[model samples]
Target: MHAMNRRLSMFRSAVPLALLLVLLTAFHAAAERIQLDIASSGVRKLAVAVPSFANGSGNPNSAAGKDIARLVISGLEFHGFIQIVEGSTNGADYVVQGRYSSMGGQMMVEASLLDTAAGKTLPTRQFRGSAAQQDDLVLRLVDALVEDFTGEPGISRTSIAFVSDSTGSKEVYIADVLGRNVRQITRHNHLCVSPRFSIDGSKLAYSSYHRGNQNLYITDLNQNRTTKAISRREGMNLAPAFSPDGRTMIVTLSRDGSPDLYRMDMQGQILDRLTQGSGINVSPSFSPDGSQVAFVSDRSGKPQVYVMDIGSKRTRLLTLQGKENVEPSWSPKGDKIAYTSLTSGRYHIFTIPVGGGSPTRITSSYGDYESPTWSPDGKQIAFARKRNGQMELCIIHANGKGERTLFRLKGNQSYPRWSPRRN
Candidate 1:
């Protein structure tokens, strides 16, 4: 056991986690305290008026204010829960009014949410940032306004990690939810895939073949992009899903001569062996509370999704309708699991209830969709679509609508993993 732990080392400190938890706790505590009926699930999209922000202060930067407003409108609309009304606030459910000022390379912006019928101004918050990082400031204000209305922060601040072969070799890359700021995370010059973000959004883990082995490695993205091999096992060290608290992860390791799921802590210490040498167990995803795990296995002569009780070590098959299923990603809400199913020789995205139900097809296009990953809010899914011998990362609403291309970069992109909302 000590040798096993030594083989799976890490490159991180404990200080950052403590600080992050404190900030996240405070953010949750200050969420929308006033109940709004329109924010409820299954409710109609709330009509909101988002006129141009006024220029108020030392420097008259009305263009900057308008730019911020435009981006915020696009961000809010992308969430699929807000309907922006252009002209009048008379028929709108709420109004977002704001002002911005810039002086000496710094920007200050404030915005307030107004309940039109109640004639009440909700919370007004001021965000400050350097002129160069104005996008961050604008997104912060956007999330604050979203929480003021929906009791949850908007996903505009989140990022998605994917594998691409742009450099003639598959490498991991990350980009904002808007598909801007595309940054390559790995330069292995060899195949690397299955990029997963820790629950805290501070760390990323993926497997690389640059060192002549498919070894698992983790990178502290919050740190100075330091990468470390947490598992250098002889064989498969594949996809890992972090637990909700970010302290532990369920990773597929084949060190014992057969691929199986193993529970390991952040420090690379094995906590428990979750699966015996089952028939090629892989692609494990943890439930929200960490009480269960959803994974793909071929124990019954075909690849299928199975849920395991973390306590009792008992497992149950979740998908029986598909000939082959792979890449089961549990929803952040803990109610559904999104995965890829091979149907009629074509791969597509599907979701099934956590309590056992028929799978609902989420993609019905001509392309083959694989590796379905959920957005932080569970409202959108990102997957890889293959058509015409080319592959690209694509996204769709949770209900199989609003499908759009997410990336049009140089090469075939696959194995998308959505990150949590940034701090």
Candidate 2:
């Protein structure tokens, strides 16, 4: 009996030890990292090969297959982090291939990412939608592929809101990152500007002159597109910016005969006055932590950027070099603030550290850049550029490289506001 008891104790100890070993091995396998050098000059871009998707049904050279491949390539290249190259079987770090089929008015797509070094393909991801959703499905697949390669999802699903004059009047319009699904949000037919999204992206607030005054209004995007006036203070109600929590907004109101910043609830009830007659304070942007705000003020004789503490109400000047600075946008990472500065007779985009430092100019061209907006990941800046008497939308990397036109519309586009990352 003593020998039997000893054997039982030994077997129990060995079982736990074996289970631990299995768990450790599985963790190590799952934690393998993909080396992507996004910051190094040695490798400016990751070499990727995206061949034409194979058609599982219908014609082999179907337009649908070609369209899917084109969109996937465009979406990946738009981020400026990856370069889509040729030669699928050789000289590529990663390869993307997919198959598509259409049946009963529904389209299905299956795609896989291949690691050339490992000589293995990742598990296939499948998506199904109607024929009209072809572009959206390709965007989803590209986002997934980005995650597999960089461990961070791409911004293909995000959207941007801006003011355009396509309908012979300045109105707000929304479009995807790739400039598709363009929809006009307002049809005031007079003048509408400064379209700002709520933190949850379910609503948009702006000021319009259609009602014969600069009044503030909010539109419920999730509901049945109901629009309501939130503020009709009589002087100027413009540039509404939501806080990080979406409970309150900081807007420039001149109801009392002086333009100042006021924090108000969603119903336009004034919660507290942030700036008490501080020299035309406007364009408030909340920090990521909701502890501070960056805005533009002309209290010191010229327009300059300033940072203010919400708790103490202490303000500090941020831009010292530029004679005129406006439209301060706090970075999502809470480290920097991007704004527009006038230098050498032209408006340029510049970024300065949140804690006060020399501003670095991100735009150097002769065109005028204004109303800079940061992406959700804080990696890019979108702004309006005007040249040759035409205004258009442009984007530049945070590091000041890869400047390119974001979209080409019939009319001028200005005041771009990027949406937060979707679930």
Query: Which residues of candidate 1, in runs, are more than 4 Å off?
Result: 1-49, 57-61, 83-95, 114-121
lDDT of each: 0.78, 0.78
Regions more than 4 Å wrong, model 2 = 1-42, 57-61, 86-90, 102-107, 128-132, 222-226
lDDT of 2 by residue, 255-301 (tens): 88767889999888999999986667778899999999988777887
Best by TM-score: 2
lDDT of 1 by residue, 48-107 (tens): 888778876534247777788888897777676677998667778778888887789998
Error of 1 at 85 (Å): 4.9
Write down the TM-score for model 1: 0.84
10 residues in a row with least lDDT, candidate 1? 11-20
Model 2 residue 61 distance off true place after TM-score fit, in angstroms: 4.1
